[model samples]
Target: MSHSMRPLLPNSPNPPRIETSSSSSSSSQHRTKRVATPAACEACRRRKSKCSAERPRCSVCVERQTPCEYTTLPTETHLRAQRRKLSNLEIRCQAYEDLFGILRSRSEEEIAQILQRLRTGEDAQTIVKTVQDGDLLLQLSLKPEFRFRYIFPYSGEMPRHLKDAQNPYIRSLLYEKTVTHLVQPPMYIETLKEISDESQKMYIAPYHTVELDDPRISSMIVSNWTTVSSDNPMLRMLLQIYFVFEFPFHPCFHKDFFLEDMFIGITRFCSPLLVNAVLATAWHGYTRMKNRAEYWQPHNLGYRFLAEALRLFELEQETPTITTVQAAAIINLVYNLNGIDELGWVYTHKSFGMAQKISLFTPNPEESTEWQMVAGVTAWCLFNWQALITFHTFQPPVINDPPSRPLPDVDEEPAYYGEILVKYPFGKEPVRIYNGSVFKAISQFRVILNDITKSFFNPSRTYSPISFEAAIEFRSKLRIWYEDLPQPLQARHIVLPCHLKIHIHYHIVLISLFEPHLHTDNAYNGVNPDMIVSQSRICFETLMRIYYLRHGFECLDTTLVQFLHLLGFSTLDEISVTENGSAANEAIRSTLMLCAKGLWEQGQNYYLSEAVFRMLRQSMSVEDVTILGDIVEVEDGDGPLNLMAQELRSRWPIGAFSKADDSKDRTLEHFIHWWQQYSEEKAQDISAMEQDGPVVPPRYPQRYGT
Candidate 1:
């Protein structure tokens, strides 16, 4: 208490020490030098080592002579985490680059203004709205007529107003003529009385029944009776094939009644025109299946029957029954299939006229359903024929008046089985082919084709080429149409032949829609060359698919010819313009060659096919010729094939050269010379035949029956 207690009062540092026992001394020493925990340094944390608490630097880091830094934030220890951070940085850089790229075209002042607005916290949507509501946008919304005035102030009605303004001199002359006519009791009145008796005699004519005995009708009657009685196997097979393959696609008759009449030997009940037409079609189908060229002969049985059918058709032209009109349409189809487009058009026109004369479009309600069905079928046949001819000729349809009657419903179930129905093996199956659905699809396509013609190829609108905008719109509609087709009409559900045909037509429509753009140069039209190439590839690829499937020849008709023509020209154009050959270009060339050879081998006698074949042969590059055999020069006796070749040479001179080689020109010249020689020979033969009253080829008997 004397020294320690007195010194501990205020600021004495050395007066607090006290003495204790050994255990107490140890506890007091521990309390005086207590240690606290500290966070690890960055180096120790990364190295996974414990650190000794020290001033400014940790012991472990100091001992290792590494930089020591303390931090509260955690350090990434996994490789994946590092990668994620790097990826985020890269994405930010990319976004910045894209933003700069988009603004590269803008003026620096504009970009600066935009950045300033963003920095100032202006809303992006509000800025955009302000810009859109500017005066420039408002002016752009005004009508073109209100924005610009014509140089001439004349109104459209000025000419009409001038004509309507009456002249005083003309009115005075009219009044004088009226007065003169009243004073002079018109001399023409007495003259008219004197001629009235003559007019009556002229209007009246003697009526007499012209005794016209048609030998073909007599022959048809005899043959029908004999053929039915003998049960000719060839005739039966031919009829079976006709019913199976042909009639199903085009059903114009009541199958049960037609078969009953044929089998029961009911001469009075049967139509001579229909019978003869069936016989001719059967003969053709039989010959085609037999792979014979006999049908080409003028005196062949098919031709004979066709001639007799025409004779009967002409005899009853004045009073054309439904059967007569149907028979005529069938005959027209036969001609079309045979590639005689002119003759087909002639017969089609005749049938359409007959349909109109008989009011087939407006049928009587009192008639039986069978009669209504026949009338509907006849109307469809006419529509189909007109659509085909119009597409092939690139002309407006002749029979443009829409049918007054509605098309047969696709959902109408078949009730009875007759000759045609019996021939179909899948008649009872769930996925059977319905003629109604096919007709409806065809009707829809006809409507589209008519629209295309009227919009693009209208004769009245001479300057109207198809705009690219309109084409895209139409192409979308066609795609939807194909996609929305009924199950029976779809490619997967229908027979391969029918499926191929429907898709072929669809692709053809696509081609037609896009073809006009290939020649256009308008920037606003948005004509994409790559799109044209793609569509053309699809079209030719579809044709190649048909060829590989072996349905090429059977489906060959004028449409096929027209499609080939388009393909050949488009291929030539692509080859000419494209300097560096691509795989697509080569594939198109090879496919074109295959199509040409296929059409040439089939030899359907279509002028278009022959022209296309000749053109491809002449236009092919030497390399193409080597890959697809050398152009075979044949002495074809058909008419001039040079028209297409000359046209091609005129349109695309670059097609004559292969990568700027002169040898291609020589090859083209040589082929052209050969074509010229063949054309000359054909002309001579035609002239000689005309002088000699037509050279009739030798006749061939019917293959099946006598």
Candidate 2:
């Protein structure tokens, strides 16, 4: 403060002077030292040289005349190191989740074994890695997809193993390949297997949009869940039934894209409306206890799903996607299956109108390169189904004609085969694949069908009535379509239900075209009545003969009901007008009762069946009912059918359907046996005839038009 001990003032002229003090220091130097006193500096550590622990610099650093730096990582380097540790922890957590999912579906014994392995000190990542890399699948996974859509139907690539074949027909043809799969491999419920119906019960709840892949999603979708939050067991079951049974025949949306999008939480090719609609359509899978009143009740699983779908439909009605159009159509199918025909037609109109609005009928060129190979498949499927329903109801089509979208090139990709449960002649519920190519075949055939529908049921049909000549042309077209079918879809090909359905659909159109003409024009126009009767009879008898193989007539195909209604009424009409209860009418009466029996069995599962059954009963007179009294069932709760069942139960003490008397020739059981025998004999006769003079598959139809 002072120089030479002079007086120091506040404003001294010569105040500057240096004074030495041991304590005075800059405040900055008080900070904790960067390098530890007990450790070598970074330079010494790097050189692997022994060093004195120093305050600022190590002796090794001093000797080298280099800056002595401490071991303090930079911000980025520190963050990187921390990130690696976090990543390792995250991986371990993921392994735990995967293991938990795997162990959940396993039996208690398996859980015990796995838990024991874990408890005995197996590391999670190690165990998870082993499980992932191995063939031991204890958890649900994507079923080993055959990607059958990629396998060409006409490929020269011989399947080294039948199991490896693209078509189920190839796998089913060999004697040694008669094995059947009862239930599909586990799908969905991947992380929620332990969740009870209560835990994951599907209901409209507070929704937050899931992270979606498609940016085109609307505000409504952005604010709402696309489907119910989690995959409940009911949802899982219905999904299985839908993809396996309904999708192939319909082929409304691309299955592969929907499935992938579904798992990834994306609403691109899938939506709440579409998922719920498909689930509602597949609600026919509720075959647990057939006599339960819940089959048609609002409390039923399907109805609940349908309600949610309709809610979403209302919300997104202003901002529709291709999925919305698909949803609306499938919802119509739900109504159709339930026999709500008017609603079905209304939705049919709605869905197709939506399709038109979205320009699906004439898709954008950019749309052709979108995710699904068949971008327009939904539009094609929608109107075609509407056409079929319209044809049956004798209602005008929803559209004057389906817009000319080229038929989907199904062979453009490997065919996707949905493993649906099918009943075979071999007495097994064999899992059959509804080949994507089969639907392609249907699309081709539908071109002619669409033409036929327009010819007969066009709104303007009164101006240009469905004349005999036009009918002949359409008839020729149908026959040609039948002959031109791919080898596996031919009339004689009994490989899949879809094959039979295609044949049935073809024959129904033929029956509609010819039956009215049968007694008049067909008889005089060289159209054989025998051929028409034989055609329908064989198809239907085969269905009845093999009913046990096809889930015992649990309304597997709702469209079948429409076809049955047509075939059934015409067949019953022949005997319904009969007055005499003589031996001449007995056989026909038995056959008619068998038809009623089919309806009666269906009634056990569907109110639509009960409704159709009532309509059929209404067509018969008291005398006709009396003539078929012992054998025929009239309708439920209408006294006759219940009484008959009661009477049989009282007298015969019947157990189950399979336990019913075979000797009682008038009983349904006896008819099933009789029909089976008749079908076998007919098949043998046809086979022998083919051997004597082979009836070659008809040539590709000359009338096919793009």
Top TM-score model: 2
Estimate every model's Cα lDDT from 0 to 1.
0.50, 0.51
Model 1 local distance difference test score: 0.50
List model 1 lDDT by residue over 129-156, tens digit each. 3432332233112222221111111111
What is the Cα-based lDDT of residue 384 in candidate 2? 69
RMSD to truth, every model:
35.9, 18.8
Worst 10 residues of 2 by lDDT: 201-210
Which stretches in model 1 have alpha-carbon errors above 4 Å? 1-231, 247-261, 264-270, 287-299, 415-431, 457-464, 469-473, 491-495, 519-533, 543-547, 550-569, 575-586, 604-706
| Per-candidate TM-score against the hidden true structure | 0.52, 0.56
Best by lDDT: 2
